[model samples]
Target chain A: MTSPQAPPALRLRRIYEVAPRDLDRAGTVSTEVRRELLALGMSPDVVRRASVVCFEGEMNMVLYSEGGRIILLVKEDRVELLFSDRGPGIADVDLASQPGYSTAPDWARELGFGAGLGITNMEQNSDLFKIRSRVGKGTVVRATILLGVPFF
Target chain B: MKLADLAGLLGAEFVTGAEHAEREVTRAFAADLLSDVLAMVQEEGVLLITGMTTPQVVRVAEVMNMGAVLFVRGKYPTQATVEYAAGAGIPLLAASRDMYETCGLLYQAGLRPAKRKGFRLDLPSGPARPAA
Candidate 1:
């Protein structure tokens, strides 16, 4: 008898790649994704959670990374976000996740972000969150927002 | 409270979306950080009061489904910001009062803080729930 084959991975309905150059561009990308999610009939609370997660991830990429890409995966029951950047990776993920701790430059503060709330905000808004980094390599963040359920 | 009422209370200048001046504002939230606003403001039709003059303010309102944005401390939005708000149908108002004063006046006028439903982490334990 032939061995049973594993099930195929879930197919994504849509994928949006946003490269944020600055805050304005970041806002644009976030807004576009939010619109798409809402159009898919996701609950308002769920969409808001996804929007915040996306915005924070986008801003972090623009601020720290040389430039990175935000990949939004629209699945049937959840929205998955992957933020990958090729920059000086975090030496301590635990320390970086702490609120009120920041390595952002002065310019980032002038833009009204870099208050050290980016990662915490992302964690708070996402149901399933993970961060992987290696010094001198890069950082990748994955956040998942389950659909249909109200976030509140 | 009506947008026009809140405008009069703050002595705000309507830069755009005058057509929506009469829309009701169910709640009010004030913050400079866009992330804080996104995380805290839970209700639709709430008024956003902020000191930030960047276009991201309007974007926040649009993404969060806010009723309108009231710029404080005499900060007027740029033309591009006004155009964006108008295009999105979100009313924009500017006031000469500072953040504290704006909140004070709005409170005096009976506008209350939006009751935010607490944020919850819904961990997937078993099978994925069916989509609604």
Candidate 2:
């Protein structure tokens, strides 16, 4: 039997092929997506939060995973984000989820965002969060947010 | 005082939000952490002073809906950062003064961070919670 398919709203709206080596580039990609989402009339508040969460998630994927793609899906009622990679998966999700838990290389911390708030902030900002991983295989994170009525 | 006036006073150059240069500023807060800035900043008219040069700085200002951001100690932002601020339409300023001195200068000039209003719980004369 085939597994159930994702809803149409969960389908990818944009797929960004970004180098998973530079956190700054990842942030730029995240910003570009958010600008388009805002232009599409998404709530400003939600867009801001989602942008940050998505940025941190993308950066984490780059720093941790071998490399991957960022898929952004927007719907009338909600937005869904998916990050997939083929790097070694998290051994202890609990520890990683902790506010200050970070395996980021020291160089990243010097860049000012590796304070270990990546997962914590993502979870805090997103309404629905899921992390799936298999040792030596990879990890995928899914985040969803309920869209608010746009003022415009 | 107007943002333009402050910019001139600090010998700082502008990046964007020039239209708001004449808008009055009433307060200032300097910080690198977005969470702290979000919790402490008063509102729309406050100027943010910080030394941390990062794109998230502009993103935080966007989220907080701040008036302007001044990078103290003559810290110039990278080209990418300037572009980000310009894209967001947030006024970015560069000042040679340190954070403390910048805050002091602004404070002496009559700009102050407004106190945040707290929620009030009315007493005996107050209306009770409505039943669901």
Candidate 3:
């Protein structure tokens, strides 16, 4: 998840795993991520934004992927959330990112997921965002919310 | 408005976190779709109105920092969901009224709607103003 826009370095925290089709455990990882961010005394704005991003990514992984893991990266000047999933990867990232566009299954749709807003929401809340996917291989999303930025 | 007063006005039964009655919320975002909630709720300390009563409802409120959740149409969350909300400090309430009347009462009682992109929320004055 290296990027020129990211700060010089970051301390990696725990990696949260999202299980496939586990409606019972869907929100677990996002809750844990929120707890850790709160424990670290991160700003409320950053924590809320990060948690929303994490929860959306977690839900996407659970709803569509075989499974996935989210890694928390805490840099002195920013926080990075990385989601990598083993799923039937998207054939079109651009098409997938469009609002209200989703390939989510019926059960997931009934549960109010697959709004097709997942990627867009993550991108909006995040100061820096990137998604990389190989059609048959998998997908990865990295969202960074910078801290102490003057213009933020 | 205080959560307790809002609950009382709506005749809602507290499913959890009655102790948080004193907390105040001046805005609300009403939606049964969890993703819509996630996408649109940008304010903390607001009420979330929904017809869904699954644990996911509470989870969404928690992540979004909603002050409390109001379940309409007589829906109620499960035991585990209530317990989870208690632990998370996000209160839950269930009202017998359907979504339409429930939102009407809330709006009439002064809980403004949460802001949305490209949508103006300002209620114009005069004859056009919605009756309380």
Candidate 4:
């Protein structure tokens, strides 16, 4: 008997590589993703939620990580975002999720980010959220926002 | 209020997106932190009032579908920032007044705070107590 064929992979509407050379270009990746989501006919509210989460993730990567990538996955019922970074991982996930905890350098603060609300904001904006990190390895953040659902 | 009327009310200069000056603004939010602004300002057509003059500010306004942005405390966006806002079709305005005074003027002009229906805080129920 022939082996069962593997199921097709989940559809990926778009993927963006967010490797900001410097802090000045940190928001570029998020901006691109937002435009793509809007063009894909995602609801405005859904796009906003995803944009906020992605923006925070992008800024964090620029300020802390050596590099990272953002993937935008669109499905019939929901939109998903994945952010993975090759950098110093979070030592304490719980502490990092706190509202006012930050390890950003002074320069990062001067650029108007690093207020320490990135992770918490991401969690609050998305309908579903998950984070994974290893001290010496890297970090990954996943956020999902369902479509056609009233956020309120 | 319309963007034009808001500009006049705050004596703001139209930095960009004059084509959208007639856009209606139903609510206002004042904050320097982008995350707070994103989390709390929930409605479309809301106006963002802030002192930060960076491209990220425009990015936030675009994502949130805000009608416009008013820079307070005489702050002005750089050329690149203005260009970005214009490209994004988000009008940018600047007033010399500080954030507090600017928000006060807008409030007096009937612009209320944006309702955050997504996140609401309620006090815990308790037994009735005597008033002090």
Candidate 5:
């Protein structure tokens, strides 16, 4: 039962904890995030991009780092996701952020991940993205997706 | 093409989501790397061609707004993965052909690439992607 309970959003916040090596339970968070976004009246385009960001962040935590938590913060103008993980932090954040530069082991590659595109994907889908990591400590990623008005 | 028609053309069978057999899907993206799928898929209702049958495949189809997934190389998903895809409402299909052949057949049938490749200025912009 370590798949992490999704507490109902008190207002516009949902938090999910991801466990390392929990490949069996991966991607559930992204699905939950998509459902919630659609329910809240967000456009499908916005929902799709946000879900991609969430899944990439979730999978990175599960496959690489020790473990981590993802927080979805929905505001009036934009939806932001906060991802923070436990150690085995990156030695160089800049190099790691580059697409196709990966340290993922062969096993992760087999499951169709660790293409070194996780960070880049998140960045591509987000209007704003930031990453900070300390070698001995951990990594924190913040991604913001701006919501546009729909002319219905 | 209709989901059912596409399945029949590939000589594939549905493992789940047969209810969506009438859904229209005109584009497809083929890859085993989930990250690549995430970065590249930009349109809604495209078909997914992959060699994997894991739950993550279904999750990607959901997240990317794909209409259905066709598994190549005779692969199949477990019950849990099928259940997840059913819940997600993304059709799942299994084909006996290898990845290369699947792509070839789909391409020959006039299915476009999943997304614009390089966004280069040299090539003519094909008819814009239809509304979702």
Candidate 6:
């Protein structure tokens, strides 16, 4: 086995273990991540955008897929989020990214979310956005926001 | 107006965060939908007015870093919701007034709803300096 690596100076300050497929945990994770980001010197505006995007993504994983992990990385200039999961992959990337497009179940909609706007909001908020997926495999989303970028 | 004033005006009772009554409130939003709240409200000192009382309400408050939550229509959220807010350090309050009445009272008190693209938060960037 390889030697373990040291925690980066600017690294994830908080780690939350959420049950796979637990939608309720989505909100809790979002709240804590936002708090940690703020404490790391991220602006409120950026933190809000990140929090919303992250929460929506987490909910998606719980509702549609087999659940996953949301890793928040705090860097000197930006906060990088990595969402990884092992679940059915997005068959149509373009369609999935479209605003108002979602595969969330009925229960998710009743809670006032899963409007297909989750990914759209994430795209709009983050300075950089990327997604990798494969059929019957899983999906990985990486989003980054500059620390001081004006969200308005 | 502060949360205490709004609570008193609406005759609402506190579920938690009674101590935060002294905190200043600069804005407010009325929506039961979490998506709209996420897309619209961004001010830190916002008073979220919603009829929907669920864990999502507290979650919304947490993610948005809202000042306080005022549940309209006299709806009181579950104890779990209250506990969630308390743990998250968010203020939670309940109001018996309907959505319209609650919004009117807050509006009359100069707590304007944010109107901007993405989200609108009207606040000074820096601490206020004492007048010379």
Top lDDT model: 5
Q: lDDT, candidate 4, residue A43?
A: 76
True contacts kept of 3: 0.58
Tell how far residue B82 is off in model 4, in angstroms.
0.9
Clashing pairs in 6: none
User: Interface RMSD, candidate 6?
Assistant: 6.2
Interface DockQ of each model: 0.29, 0.12, 0.39, 0.40, 0.40, 0.26
lDDT of 3 by residue, B1-132 (tens): 998899899999888889998999999988877878877887788899998887778888998899999999888888889889999989998999998898899899998988757522222333565788
lDDT of 1 by residue, B1-132 (tens): 888888877679888998987799978998887766766777788899988888888888988899999988888888888898899999999898899988988888888897557543232245677999
lDDT by residue for model 5 over A53-106, one digit each (tens)? 999999989988899899989887788899999988999988887778889899
Query: lDDT of each prediction vs. the true structure?
Result: 0.80, 0.72, 0.84, 0.83, 0.86, 0.77
Docking quality tier of model 5: acceptable
Error of 5 at B100 (Å): 0.9
Q: Kindly provide the TM-score of model 2 when superposed on the true structure, using C-alpha atoms.
A: 0.74
Interface quality of candidate 5 as DockQ: 0.40
Error (Å) of candidate 6 at residue A68 is: 1.2
Q: Would candidate 2 be rated incorrect, acceptable, medium or high by CAPRI criteria?
A: incorrect
* Preferred candidate (TM-score higher): 1 or 2: 1
Quote the positional error of residue B41 for candidate 4 in Å: 1.2
lDDT of 2 by residue, A98-134 (tens): 7656787776666555566677767766888998888
lDDT of 6 by residue, A1-152 (tens): 53456433576644555467565565677877877877877666777888988877776676677667788888766788888888788898878877666776787677666766667667777899998888899888999887766654
Q: Which digits, one per residue and each the tens of the lDDT, describe model 3 over residues A7-68?
A: 56655578888899898878878788888889889877888888889988988888888898
Chain A of model 4, TM-score against the native?
A: 0.88
Off by over 4 Å in 4: A1-11, A148-150, B118-132
lDDT of 5 by residue, B38-132 (tens): 87778888899999777888888988888899999999999999988888788899999999998898889888887755522222335687899
Candidate 2 Cα misplacement greater than 4 A, ranges:
A1-12, A148-152, B8-11, B15-19, B24-29, B33-47, B59-66, B107-132
